[model samples]
Target: MKELIPLRLSILGHPQRLAVFRLLMRRYPDQVPAGEISDALKVKSSTLSSYLSALLQANLVTKTREGTSLRYQVNMETTRETLDSLYLDCCRGRPDLCTSYQQPVAPKERHMTDRKYNVLFLCTGNSARSIFAEAILKSKGQDRFEVYSAGTQPQSSLNPIALEMLKAKGHDTSALRSKHMTEFIGEGAPDFDFVFTVCDQAANEECPTWEGQPISAHWGMPDPVKATGTHAEKSLAFHQAYGVLQHRLQGFAALPFDQLDRISLQNAVDEIAKTSD
Candidate 1:
């Protein structure tokens, strides 16, 4: 108790550190990049490092590596504990202020249930990125999601490179084909629970509004179709796209959808972009 007070006080005493902590708490529960944090707070990199280090030492914040990017988030448990300790001390002799202090409710547990979610992956040509995402998620989701892919402009045929890559990895390429996005929007189509745009072009293009107000996110990636140079280079680009989609889809499948509410699920989907290549 003697040692804890000063540790907590030292973290809260500095204005810059407090600002960074508060900013993280307000923006996202997942995590935000250091560059975004610094930009928003108008703090220099050297100075931000010192502030982040202080918070980290006090256990008020945590830093994690997502690929090559560094993400920071508030350590809510420690912050709550420190605040609770202070309130306890001040409320010992006072009753009125104590009356309104309620213990924070814990977040609900996230777990997968039997209910299957419908998801759509969209892209411009439905050739590489979206097709790969759909195939990967369908296999990895383990029948937990009804996965589909479509495009604004349907290709005459699926990209040969994407097909070969999936087949090499033991993914079934039988049912996969390029289809227009309008097919899903018309009558008798499965209402989607989640929709993700896997390329910048489709994400920006105007499209039919979904029926169920499904949670949507942009998981933009470089188009492998435009890869130029030697045959090996083009093949490698497709391989990399496949790998990136595999990583992203695996993370998506691991999410505890039954436990998280709509907003949390949306946030989780968006955070995947930061963690992926």
Candidate 2:
């Protein structure tokens, strides 16, 4: 067997270091100051400095002096090589799977800010994934997408597991609650740009088309509460679902909805719903 490379070992051995690397990767090619890293990771400057030094030594990150401050950014060339090496190591001699796992190219940015769109998420329980999808889109989408969530049969309280997962991810959930879809369906309900059914039952149920006849989509996710296990086990399920929703919603929010025609907008929603599965 061929020897595994040192860079792969360095990264895989230190989970915290890998997390820092991911953070930098997410903000790729952007020079971030030490304080930002410290804040994001909740690590003290003194502690983070040691990790940063190790990364610099490993050639995973590059540092530049900006006045008295030092900015650190991912060394993309080295990072790419490291990733390639890891892929080769994992696949051993299987070139097909290794080649098939190439990173996807980012979609081209479309300039479409002339109009605004409102989105509504509906589910049977409205307690876990639906609430999470709503909160994430509202926070991440900002002015790009107006978002809300409702339930067919509303729960008396928000799901504790869902709230905990959101707070753990540094998201504010104080303003989130379980609301009835009826509140938004009648005379007072604001017309939605899109209405999404996040549960199978809600998707199949016969209901009046939305007031605005908004584009409708279905995204079905397993109920985290149905998982039978300890509290920790249940929490893990919620966290996993939260991650999936967060990733998909981020992409959906980034779409140029204003520029797309109705058919195009519907297509965009359909594409995003596919990710939920």
Candidate 3:
């Protein structure tokens, strides 16, 4: 409905609710338990209850019972109502702004940051892809970036194949362990400059709010652990994923961040996954 835009935006205007909406959006087409949402957003049960109620009342998200708990999901059908409204509004009002968004920088140009950037990679399990990304950036951008990785529903251990890959590449894996995403929030968490979700199962992943709003993107890929082939095939999957993430990270590292504005920098960060395998 045409009325949904304001209602939806208004409902999402609350910071906690907006975070909840984004967490749900990342997990679109699937339902997440209210408990899970609370854990992911670091919200108290009471605050999350109100956020969910507002989202549900605005029809921005829908929920169903999951045993004793409630599971919520993005109302895709309702989502489209807002999308259609925005599309038509842009077409009718600011048609020039509706055109394809173009990146403002030259592809190969390298830029420098005056200070080290804090970056985080997230995945459902901090085993393979995200671990590799953290390792890769820490290794390559040693002076330029501080890197970390975590999972939404963390696995109890790291993936063996991933460990082998990093070892062969001579990266120190001693500091690596599968960790919960919440460990980075609250207390003395480092403020992040960029956050990327490197898992295909994004719905199971949580997008937390950083102290400062960090640039984020879904650099999603299939989990090598879930690969159903021989050991070699699984390793190859891990290798392929590493290459893609490595390339994307290199591209990110090369961007002249000090020169680009926030919008351009975000576009650059988001373009990496698309441009790299």
RMSD (Å) per prediction: 9.9, 16.6, 8.9
> Which has the higher TM-score value, candidate number 1 or candidate number 3?
3
What lDDT score belongs to each candidate, Candidate 1 first?
Answer: 0.78, 0.72, 0.78
Clashing pairs in 3: 27-203, 111-256
User: Against the hidden reference, what TM-scores do the models get?
Assistant: 0.61, 0.57, 0.64
Best by TM-score: 3
User: Model 2's lDDT to the true fold?
Assistant: 0.72
The TM-score that candidate 3 achieves is 0.64
- Candidate 3: 10-residue stretch with minimal lDDT: 100-109
lDDT of 1: 0.78
Report, for all candidates in order, the number of backbone clashes: 0, 0, 2
